[model samples]
Target: MSDTHAIAFVRNEMLPQAEPPVTQRGLVKWLRENMFSTIPNTIMTLLSLYVIYVLLASVVPWLFNGVWSGDSIRDCRAALDGATGGCFAVIRERWPQLLFGSYPSNLLIRPTMAFFLLLLAAAPVLFSELPRRLLWFTALYPFLAYWLIWGGSIWVPLFTIATILLSWLVFRALESRSFFGAIVAALIVFVVVSIVLGGPVVALLDSIATIRLQPVESRSIGGFLLNFILGTTCLSLSLPLGIALALGRKSDLPFIKGLCVIIIEFVRGVPLITLLFVASVMLGFFLPGGVDFDLIIRVIIMITLFASAYIAEAIRGGLAALPKGQYEAADALGLDYWQAMRLIILPQALKISIPSIVNIALGLFKDTTLVSIISMADILGMTRQRIMNTSEWFGVYWELLGFAALLFFIVCYSISQYSQYLERKLATDHR
Candidate 1:
């Protein structure tokens, strides 16, 4: 009786695994919980499905049956023969102008090289896991890119690089003695050297030895190339400038703080379109006689300044979010202000500010479209001037605009996805 009682609960083999119920597992479970968890949710889900279906029903056939080969909208319509289809031939015919604008066909290789090289330069900066040495290329890329796209005497960018290096050297020599003095000296050296190099020095260098590309005017730069140039240039410039402005706004020096405040406030108060107008029309008046400032350069400057103001506020918000103890900890470690900021405060603040900064970048990139108002030929501008203005492609707005929209969406969506990935990679809250 005792042996029998002890052995009663024992089993010789394990039980077989059973599948979960249809409504409680896999796709069925997911649909039940997320799409039909409650009556309201079910109703909303069904309504959304219906709307999506209605849209796809029309869109799918139209997109799939689009006439891609045609000389004009009429040709496209004729090909469609009363069937519903998109006249996408406009995009096919105007593809080059849409991408490179009025850029010379033979010189296309220049921008193409710059474009691919840009990816190489950006890779290390975007992904920190890459070798830090790649930053050398990143630093040099701007000047190289300028030479490539604008197609000029290589000495122009070379001298420009020299100016920067000269200024940096001066700053380094004076930095330990007096930080403020170092900055002033560096700035003065930069300006003076820039003036000398821009004129006689460049000319003299050209006489001695020449490395030249077929010169292309800034005016010739249009299409998506122009948009990329503006967006990348402004985005790259605004971040560091904004960081400096954010720091200046918090400085103990009243003059520095006041100046920073004025710049940030003034730029923020003005509409960007107004700023663009100033760049296009008013900027010429400010320059000395016979000093031709390229319109693209002026627009870039204006756009960069506008973006910097917003970015400064975003960075400032990030800085403000840090605890007082972080500052105290820096002080306790015997770190000076800049040291503390660079080593500790800024890193964390930048991580926090990533989302805001990415938003600013996206906004600045899209705002390149606004250059069309000033008669600059960005992608949108090319569409208007080169395609739609022509009799053949007149009223083919949807296809051209849709192509531009698709290009922007691809770039912006990639940026957003990268930012999300970065946030996940840098996340410390879980630890």
Candidate 2:
């Protein structure tokens, strides 16, 4: 151990940093780890790339060579001159009908306005960071949407709002005394007010106030607009009803639990198509004589019920998954059933159920296409009835169907993305 050993241990100098290997840094590293790390992964990646290339090769040419300025399929074919190309003129010509069905051309502004307003109305409900006051608009949106789309006297929706407010007031007055009693009394008040005030009282108010637009019947509603209406209305209606059913099914009372069980089981057992058939054909027979139920309304009711059953099961799953300690925590807090549920249970349960609920909602939105079997002209229905049947675009299936698919994909993808966002936002485990 001489001076040489001492110098070896003590002497030091900084070595210049060396760059990482090309395979271990930047885009190359990412590609290696994600796409080519294993032999199977590399093979799969190459196959996927090939498939994508093949798809783009075929699609890009067709898209680029599409006939956008043709009067008919024949004209489109002529324009293509025997080359493979898309007859997109069908979409161009029937764009309005595909979007709005038989909605009056001049009155398109109404639905357009309602559509944009819908975004505004839903903003508060969907994203809770918004001011709570915006919920008032969300509550009023249904009536306003109905008035705008249906072009009815303003007094109808106004009176409808009044009826709900008054009934709710009655409920509040009784709520402190008895919950069940409050609900029953409030329902009675609602029916009485609807019958007494909705007809003559609305008529009287309309005559004096007199705000009206040209009426648009339910029959006139078709295309994507019809699908949007059905999807939004049914989803909105089903969520609360589903929550109630889930809670009812879990109740201590046998009757409530049994009733909810029956509803959920029966609905789940039946095919949605069968339910749609009942709505289209059989439902009218159950109604009172001389009562004219709008076909759309009947369909909405059936769809909502169908969606509610599934949603209830989803929420029930969420509820069942909750820890017993959560319930105990609520009890420890001296909270009663409703108080515990509202304050401590439902939010967590709903967060857990979001994925399931969104899945159901997506399926429901797509199922709206089945309305065509009963002659409602949603986007697919419009393509079938108005475009496919016509001589001008009789053979144009891909373009019209593709357009519909694109719209559906956009909407469904957006919903999926939002659900993912919400899951991440509400995630406590990550925190």
Q: Write down the lDDT of every candidate, Cα atoms only.
A: 0.93, 0.92
Model 1 steric clash pairs: none
| lDDT (Cα, tens digit) per residue for candidate 2, span 135-161 | 999999999999899998898888889
Lowest-sum lDDT 10-residue window in model 2: 2-11
Q: Can you give the lDDT of residue 186 in candidate 2?
A: 93
Summing lDDT over every window of 10 consecutive residues in candidate 1, give the lowest-scoring window.
1-10
> What is the lDDT, from 0 to 100, of the residue 398 in candidate 2?
89
**TM, every model:** 0.95, 0.95
C-alpha-based local distance difference test score of model 1? 0.93
Off by over 4 Å in 2: 1-13, 37-42, 428-431
**Model 2 alpha-carbon miss at residue 108, Å:** 0.3
Model 1 residue 51 distance off true place after TM-score fit, in angstroms = 1.2
